[model samples]
Target: MRITRMLGAAALLFGLTVTPAVADASPSPSASGDDSAPTSAGTSFRTATEVDQGQRATASASTGDYLYWSFPADAGQRPTVRATVKLPATHAAQTWQVDVYDGLRRRQSCQYGAQTRTAEQGSATVELACVLRTVRAWSEPWANDPLPGTYYIRLTALNLTTADLGQPVNASVRVGSKDIGGSAAVDGSLAKPLVPGIAVSSQSDSEDGDTSKAAVLSSIEPDGGWTSGWWSDRWVWTGIGAVLAALAGIGGYALTRGSGRPSRVPPGA
Candidate 1:
């Protein structure tokens, strides 16, 4: 009975040490009511308009233009992107779509939402939306799980009549996120968001007004830089320590277990 009690205590201690820590729930993403945000979208990834979560972004462009916007996503968030296109008066039907891509430029599949819509002839607007899977703290190299990073949204006219190609159009995009909190946390988090470094002019521009001379990422970092958050690879070392502790408990129990009463030589001569 004493040995059994010791073993039980060891297991309980191990469980306590390795229990996954969870953070308190934080507020949801901000609302899209900020009117002061810029009202333009980028034509390409390099120039993608960066917006805060749930910020309203609008742009005026031709029917077939590709409008791109980017936003940061933290772990445990499920980001949903909704886009609306105000179409000019036209008799031709058209198809519009909004695609979400990770910072690696890899397209992420939408778990739900109407990602594409075909506007009927004379329709005033077309709306599309996408709900991405929950962001993960960490994932295996072979897995394509969504991780905390900078995500991009690309809106374009997928199918349109040739005559409607250059028709004037207006678009608005909003990205909102739902925080799932610590329920979906894993052993570690990414060291940084997969944000690209924007090109910056060389300091030589100070002497010469010409700003053409450029330096790549060598000098510039993304605004605020990247952070690892609370979770990190150190969890691996913690897990190893827990395992070693459990093993040591078993070894100690084996060395000291049972036969507490000193054994006398059985009927020693």
Candidate 2:
């Protein structure tokens, strides 16, 4: 009974240490917005218009112009960008494409979607969508896994007729996200999303200055810097390690303990 009680106590300690570390996490507050969001698109990444998830931004642009918009993404999110271009009636077919990039400026590959499409000469509009991989809490220094950060969506004409150059068109883009919950949770996170330019703002201090000019041409970091994430798998691992250590100590005591240790006496004594 005493040995059973010791085992029970060890099991109870393990449960307490491991469960809360993985279960008590709360995601950061997401950026919010309505349908009609941005009024214009940025000419360059430095000036990309800020848009929140579920918000749509539209602007009048030329066929070959690069239109840009940016949004915040958090860990465990799979963000999908959808774009529509209403081209003016033309005699030549046109190819349009939408590309997404992480805050590091590395172009992220779409999981699957109509990222590029050709609009028939008489077609009224061309639609494009790019689905990004789930945002990870952390990735290897060399790995390009999509981590939480500001993501950019660029819309442009890939192959348009020479005569269609400078032709006016209407462009719109929208962003949405699906959370992966605790399934994709990890033991680590970035100190900050790969956004450049602005100083890493702390909760106490707001910001530094426009330092990203040389790096990103423009900084589109979130209003407040990203939080380093709330929960981690390290807690669970640590608890498990402690439980093993304690169990080892208990087992060693049980095995090594005997009737008594001889004092200066012979075995026969």
Q: Pick the candidate with the highest lDDT.
A: 2
Residue 8, candidate 1: Cα error in Å is: 27
lDDT for model 2 comes to 0.77
Worst 10 residues of 2 by lDDT: 198-207
Expressed as tens digits, the lDDT of each residue in 20-70 for candidate 1 is: 332223435466668777589899987888887767889999988999988
Task: Assess each prediction's global lDDT (C-alpha) against the native.
Answer: 0.75, 0.77
lDDT of 2 by residue, 149-239 (tens): 8888899997667899999999988887775555667778887666644334332144445443334433444334464455545546666
Candidate 2 clash figure, as a count: 2
Error of 1 at 211 (Å): 18
Pairs of colliding residues, candidate 2: 46-218, 197-212
Relative to the unseen true structure, what is the C-alpha lDDT of residue 250 in candidate 1, on a scale of 0 to 100?
A: 77
Question: How many clashes does each candidate structure show, in the order listed?
Answer: 0, 2
Pull out the clashing pairs in model 1.
none
